[model samples]
Target: MVHFMSFLIAFSLIAVSGKASSGFLYPQFYDHSCPRAQAMVKSVVAKAVAKETRMAASLLRLLFHDCFVKGCDASLLLDSSGTITSEKRSNPNRNSARGFEVLDGIKSALEKECPQTVSCADILALAARDSTVLTGGPSWEVPLGRRDSRSASLSGSNNNIPPPNSTFQTLLTKFKLQGLDVVDLVALSGSHTIGDSRCTSFRQRLYNQSGNGQPDNTLDQSYAAQLRPRCPRSGGDQNLFVLDFVSPTKFDNAYYKNILASKGLLNSDQVLLTKNKASMELVNLYFFGGQLSTWPTT
Candidate 1:
């Protein structure tokens, strides 16, 4: 009962409508299966990532938020003003306004192509996977057909997401709760290869530790020295960025390999390799031994 081509027709009209102004097309004219409709979705998402880092970050964040909490419920995609609550966060919600704009872009394109036939939830899932590949993570085909959520909850922060300091056990529990197996956890963590966290988020591992062969200590001694100027005492403007200078913006298994070499960027990342058998096993397979080349195959 989904007409796909109409969605493309709608987007083509928007493209032709000129850059000065564009709005939703007639709902009656929307379709679902059109290749153009899918193309519009891809095109709009790409434009968002190109113009706004926050937009891209938020999309990836939403995917992690959803999968870690409620099995990819797409709950994080809802706007707070839209008659719903959202999950909680240790820090204030860093919801990016640009993220909403990108969502709108997708919604508008879909509306022109298929009216309201496609759900916002589906768009959210697709956007997350699309965002991941854009940021140099593995590409996996996600099945579509998700429905829009009517409400958002601030309480989702409680048990859904893992904090930067979460222990190995806690991280495993969090991911397992989301229906992801150990392999998925290791595979997904590769996301850290891009982006950044605040310096204060992981300074304790550097200044407070008794010399352990930790990557934070080996952080290009020069890089660590430069960070001190910005993070002074691990507070105020200590936010660390997660960009993997070696391969920024290319989806690959390099992140896993970094862990084996003790180049993990965060304490949580390092802990996965050092603590617990299940985690160590996966880390060894992917990071230590380079088994991720055909990961998810087993």
Candidate 2:
């Protein structure tokens, strides 16, 4: 769980105005500066996702991690040099966060078309939006003209991104700090429907969850048994498991349904139902189509 005070600081940073004269994001920031920016980003992302569907989820998660740390300023993309320490080495990102190659490709194409016209920050935002749409999710006009950060924050990355083992209250607190509510939490978590989680992310739930040499009781026994063979107590930390077993490659509400059945892959996910009434209601809303009345609104 992230500290409450840190959350406050994060929100404060996000509230700061950008360097643009208007200090706000708009959909057409690059209309004159670079006309084909959006098309190039979408084309690259589409090709990458078409080659590997999971890349869609990876790109979306990368954007989320970036925004949470430094208000989506592209700090996560910076490589370590002189005074800069890359956030890529942070705990939450080390071996888990990916999709950098796709971003590099987009940046290269944009630079060739119009040098330094497209900021990496806007590229990330566009890539995230395109990834969602490519994966059968919603499409939206991503505001552009975000400036890139000259510095990166490894500590911020480690502290801000919620861990898989976080408590439900802690996860909600993190979301609230970002001006997101239970609805956003449930909605955004649906991204897990398409991604994969490493064994290290959920090993505790498979063995010695409470230091009692027993699997987590909240996890379905059959699922736990199914997970242990590949996710052994000792090794196989890098093995991957689909986050949403029911629809592993789709961006839908099946993730909510999995939580309802105690089949959630991560403790942070299962706690949505066990820890709070509001979250449970939200989960049910998505599960039964009450909240999903307007579908594909990711």
Range of the 10 consecutive residues with the lowest summed lDDT in candidate 1 = 13-22
- Model 1 over residues 76-173: C-alpha lDDT tens digits? 56655645555533242452212656877888887887776765655666676677656544344445545555555566665557777677777777
Quote the lDDT for 32 in model 2.
Answer: 93
- Encode model 2's per-residue lDDT on 1-298: one tens digit a residue: 1122223223332232222222578889899989999999999999999999999989988888888786778898999999999999999999888999999999999999999789998898889878877876655667677888888999999888889999887887887776666666766766687899999999998886568887788899998889889998788999999999988887667787899999999999998888887777767765674533443221
Task: Give the TM-score comparing model 2 with the true structure, all chains together.
Answer: 0.89
Stretches of model 2 off by over 4 angstroms after superposition: 1-22, 291-298
- Report lDDT (CA) for all predictions: 0.55, 0.80
Q: Judge candidate 1 at residue 103 and give its lDDT.
A: 70
For candidate 1, the lDDT comes to 0.55
TM-score of each: 0.73, 0.89
